[model samples]
Target: MLMTLLMIIFAVMVTALALTLVLLISGVHTFSTSFSPLSVSLASTLFGLGVGLLMFGGALLLFLISFEICKLIVKLITPSIR
Candidate 1:
């Protein structure tokens, strides 16, 4: 049950990462086209958001990995009474 929940969360994070990547690409394209104040601001905002999401995804992935490792260790150490 916990694994299933983690998988769902991972899926959502992947989707969000993809979306943020798209936004980052679009922002770069927009910046390349012109140098207006609004365009620059929008591009920067998109860049920041994309970077933030990427960082968050990395952290979540680490957390999931550690959780799984801990579960594995506990399983190995615990006696099989049943």
Candidate 2:
């Protein structure tokens, strides 16, 4: 049951990461099209990209950690007959 919950959470995180990537890509296109000051536009674009990447990366890391921990728990719980 715990593993199932973790799997669901992992799925949600993956979905969020995909959405974030899409948003970041759209932002890049918007920045490219707008006629804004070079310095300001560059700063904002970098900041946005950095934040998006960080969120996606953090989610992925958490999902991986949860999966490993769950796998280890399952291994420990199940009886093995040699």
lDDT of 2 by residue, 19-59 (tens): 65665566555545443466467667677566656655665
Off by over 4 Å in 2: 1-40, 80-82
Best by TM-score: 2
Which residue window of length 10 is worst by lDDT in model 1? Answer: 73-82
Q: What number of backbone clashes does candidate 2 have, counting pairs of residues 3 or more apart or in separate chains?
A: 0
**Whole-model lDDT, model 2:** 0.60
Total backbone collisions for each predicted model: 0, 0
All candidates: CA RMSD (Å): 7.8, 5.8
TM-scores, one per candidate: 0.45, 0.49
Top model number, lDDT: 2
| Model 1: residues with Cα > 4 Å off, grouped in runs | 1-40, 80-82
